[model samples]
Target: MDLMQWYQKAMSSDAYLEYMKENKERTASILEKFSIPEEDRELLERIGEHSLKVIAITEDWCGDAMVNIPILLKLAEAANIEVKMILRDENLELMDQYLTNGTSRSIPIFIFIDEEGKERMVWGPRAPLVKKVVDDENAKLPPRDHEDFPLRKKEMIQRLGNLYSTDRTIWQEVYDSLKTSLVQSILM
Candidate 1:
């Protein structure tokens, strides 16, 4: 079945809300702070006449998704795009279609479908700038450090959380770039 059909199937069975309801922690708090900027509002306008459907694979417990999906939703909404979310665990086949590094099943992988139901663009797993921070931090670490690794994990999560919370512009740029690329591809 196509993604829209899958979205309908997930929605009718209440699976969609189940995931949203389970994500109450961050989603609730983020709603208050999340705002689509004027620049990004302009970016969305460039989408032109294309009808886009963003099908997201996410899970409630994902820290990255908690930070990213809401922003994407707001920007997409500004562009009159429709977004449907499905949990990663429940949609492994769909998740598999858009993996990280060709092997890892990553949450928050958004598969963009056109009005014809063809997959057009994909964005995901994490924001690119944030991923850069993570990559830089990981490169500095001992590859297999057994000592204090758990402590390091805690520190890293805290640092990444700080990265997302403080560096708000990156998310908007991410949306801008994503929308720009989609428009470029469509116009190409």
Candidate 2:
């Protein structure tokens, strides 16, 4: 299928907002709480000048999406860009094309496309800092073969979600990483 055509078939931010309202409390909380910094106004304008549209491959239940989507919506609003959401599980044809590490079907992949539908850039899942935080937590867990590993892994994920909900610093990391990547892509 044509990528642009598929993007047109994706759900609008308004519909996704309704989906979040019905599906995930954490994502709704993040959306309500996150805000773009004042310093980003100029950069946001610059991004807007490009007239890009983004398709977010995501699911409400995803922890990474809990952190990333809210920030992205804030940015999209500030920059006057349009964004659409496509559920990853339901859109594997597109999700598979943007797989993380060419393996994992990571959600929250932002595919920024120009007016002609040519992909300008992609960003997603987690920033380096966020990944580091997750990795550090994983390192503290028991070996995968251990009997307690499953429980510990689930608890660790919960802890991370809690952290994402309350930690403004992690939000900033996501904002900064997204800004850097987007700015770089615009430059290119």
Candidate 3:
């Protein structure tokens, strides 16, 4: 099927918003707290003129999705871009094409497309800075075979979740990364 067909079959932004209301409290929280920075507002407006759309391959349960999707939604709103959400597990056909490291089936991949449904850029899973922060945290974990590993891992996930929810610096990093990519793809 063509890209438009895929987009037509996917969940609309309204439908995705309704779907999130059921169990995506974290995502909802992030949306409530996040906003496009004033300096970035004009950039989004400029992007809006292109009439772009994005397909977000994701699921509600992913912590990365919980953090990143809201930012995308906000940008989409300001930029007047449309978004269709395709559940990764249900749409492995598309998800497989954008795997993290060509191996992991990571959620929250954003595929930006123009009005003609031509792919412009792909972004996802985590920003470079975000990945570094996550990797550094993971590096401190004990070996899997160690007795403290399980507890440490669990605690680490909890801490990251907490940080993702409350830290505006991380949110700004996410915005900066996406802005850079969008500028390269649409402006420069």
Candidate 4:
């Protein structure tokens, strides 16, 4: 099924609606905190003018998905950019192509593509910075209980902890970097 269908189906679920309602205030606060600046607002206009397509993979049951998806949707709305949401497990082929490290099925992977269908910027729950920390050679990381996916809950918690600990600085960096990248991609 297409992304719209997936989104409709997911929204139809009571659990999904409940999740959104429960986190509405927190989500709004985060969006307000991360408001794009005037300079970046022009970049957002460029992103909208380019009319790039954004494919987002997410699931309702996921906490990270719940948090990030709302932020993404709000960003798209503010920028007037088009977006499509899809469930990860429901679409294996697309997921396989974009899945990191050939295994992780993390959600809210935002895939940005230009008019000609060329990929430009991709961002979401798992950023490269976090991945590097998770895979550090010198660091002793916890093992995954499930053989299928190593570093599930443990890594997720660690990532969340790291995020909370350094949210202000890291979020600013990520926002600026992403804005610059998106602007450059569309302008180029």
Best by TM-score: 2
**What are the per-residue Cα lDDT tens digits for candidate 1 across 1-188?**
78777655444113443446545555545545778777656657666357877777888767677677767767777788777777789778777777799999877787778887888887877667767877887776655657867778778877776666545675665566566667676656
In model 3, which runs have C-alpha deviations exceeding 4 angstroms?
21-23
Candidate 3 TM-score to native: 0.93
Displacement of residue 22 (Cα, Å) in model 3 is 8.3
Residue 32 of model 2, lDDT score: 88
Ranking by lDDT: 2, 3, 1, 4
Local distance difference test, candidate 4: 0.58
Pairs that collide in candidate 2 are none
TM-score winner between 1 and 4, please give it: 1
Candidate 1 vs 3: which has more lDDT: 3
lDDT of 1 at 85: 76
Error of 1 at 29 (Å): 3.7
Give the per-residue lDDT digits (tens) of candidate 2, residues 113-133. Answer: 999889999998899999999
Per-residue lDDT, model 2, residue 132, is: 97
Candidate 2 lDDT score at position 175: 91
What is candidate 4's lDDT per residue for 1-188, written digit by digit as tens? 44334334443222443445444454445656765556566667767877776777766555455455555655677577666666677777667766766677766677776665567787766445544543462155445444634555556555654463336554454455555566676677
Clashes of 1: 0
- The lowest-lDDT stretch of 10 consecutive residues in candidate 3 is 14-23
Q: What TM-score does candidate 4 get on C-alpha atoms?
A: 0.65
lDDT of each: 0.69, 0.89, 0.87, 0.58
Better of 1 and 4 by lDDT: 1
TM-score, one value per model: 0.82, 0.95, 0.93, 0.65
For candidate 4, which ten residues in a row score worst on lDDT?
Answer: 5-14
For model 3, residues 22-58, the per-residue Cα lDDT tens digits are: 3377778889999888887898999889988899998
